[model samples]
Target: MVYTISAPPHKKQRITFSSINRAKILTLLPVSLISIYFFGLPALGILLAGILAAVATEYGIQMIFKQDVTIKDGHAAMIGLMLALLTPPEAPLWLPVVGSFIAISIGKHAFGGIGSYIFNPVLVAWVFIRSAWSDPMTPLSIPHIGQFSDLLLEPGAGLLVGVSPIALLAGLYLIYKRYVEWRVPLLFFLTVFFFNQIIAFVSEIVTLVQEGVLNPLLYLATMFTFLELTEELSFAMVGVVIFGIIFLATDSPTTPVTKQGRLIYGVVCGLLVSIYGLFGNYVDGTLYGIFLANGVASFVEARTIPASFSQESVLERSYNRVMEKIPSALKFEVISDD
Candidate 1:
């Protein structure tokens, strides 16, 4: 038995930069595969162009900064792939390539290289291109998958109507591997439901008021009927929101590390996304939501910081902060024409 003993098993490398990057790639593969399958050559071209440009940008920027190259970590490539996937299928190849460069230079390098970046680099580039060249960046078409419905409520407008098994599986995989915390996503979906209901109820109320009906039960029926009709196709059911929550919003370096802090972060992001989508006329609010969430992470995290002698748990501390700010925020100001 001693002679037949096998060599000691190799120690599993715990979560590291490399593992995190690889997990992200795996999580996104399903989306990429499906896009390429449906969109054919154009999708492939955009994906390749973005990846090539990102790698080139990463290499060039590293040289410029005279920093040790970290392209092998696969982060640049991941960003490139995500950028391509997010771009409109009809977008000029140059758009993705340029976006890839900005993703590398401004989004990554400018923030002190890989792990130090404050926000999701892919989203940073997305916010830039979508703002500057809104035409090309906006999604033009949903690819036709044989008999599969394009799921468009109206041409080039409305929430998606189908659940994406690919995205769902990938997201589940990420959660299973513990690459992302469950609470961030769990709280996110909860807030999305709560927030969406509020928006839906309000919108229905306005419509009923305009149509001249004061019956609450009738209003409830009308609202529920409308919700039932489109519930399967609303923004919450759409693939993009699910995909973004799992992949983009859960970036380790960018999101809060504290367990309770993540809940607040997710809630804020989800609520904002709902507001933007329902009220602000944005096609997809997930992108902007994550960008804004990461930007304001400092404030969210600050509330969860453990006090030296204070008995406050995470929620207590955050609650105190909110209470402390309410008076100042609610203070009235009147301007006099002197």
Candidate 2:
């Protein structure tokens, strides 16, 4: 009699690795189609280049290494589509190809594949391409900006996914499906919103002062009376923040494991985005911010884990060792009742 030995996830559930990828693909399909509608053939060409390059690269690497072919799982294709969405519409075809190649070979595979990777592979590839070729990464200006519909449907500036409200709705579905947790994305948005408002308010105050407006107290009183204290916040990159927090920052393997750690990590990512956005470009800042946060995710997870009282923690052990070195008179022992 032969007994088959299998991996630890022996208990079956509806959500499998492949199923998750399929859900992601479905969620992102609308975004891709809308990108084509707005940007036309160039967008189509870029999307194809990224997807094909990622799939082909993953296939070639697996074949050469004589490993099980996992391309059918759709992880490679998802990475490709995501990279393409973040790309500028006018970017050359070769750009996605190169980015996809890097994403598969180095970003995904080099770090021990899929769940073992420490960084979001798409963001890794994007940084590489942007740093190497800054010129082509600049997005083209939209010809006209008139109706509010344009902002929701197509604002042809910054990254392709920057102003896409569809992306936000799709991201919400991912949350509903239980594929992603609500903590990180929620904290990230809250941090960005509050920080941005504070910055804007301070800037407005400075502007008023520069314009020779007298009686600061009167300005404050008028603000309170009219309820005009809060400035209108621009959510130009809300789509980018939503999509990124959902797909990139919350990547199961790379992000924090504990709920508290995830919340802290999200705030850190948002703060970095806000700071970088002030000093540089918003789209670039979002990518870099997430990348930096990924670097510290493991550390955050380690510290956030609740220490067991039954076992001695590292800090406790160290303190005990230090106490042992001190003179007997200097340390008092607690008397335990029998």
What is the lDDT of every predicted structure here?
Answer: 0.73, 0.80
* Error of model 2, residue 68, in angstroms: 0.5
Q: Which prediction has the highest TM-score against the true structure?
A: 2
What is the C-alpha lDDT profile of model 2 across 210-249, one tens digit per residue? 8888865478556643223222234433556667777888
| TM-score per candidate | 0.79, 0.83
In candidate 1, list every pair of residues with a backbone clash.
none
TM-score of 1: 0.79
| Root-mean-square deviation of Cα positions for candidate 1 versus the true structure, in angstroms | 9.3
lDDT of candidate 1 over 1-338, digit per residue (tens)? 35555677544658777787788887677667666665667778888999999999999988887889888999899899888877866788999999999999999889888678998898989889989898877675432222224332123322121124335446677788787789788887778777767766777788778888878557687557643535623556456676677778888778887777898899988888877776553335777887888988778787777766758777686678877778765856688999
Among these predicted structures, which one has the highest lDDT? 2
Clash totals in order: 0, 0
Locate the minimum summed-lDDT window of 10 residues in model 1. Answer: 153-162
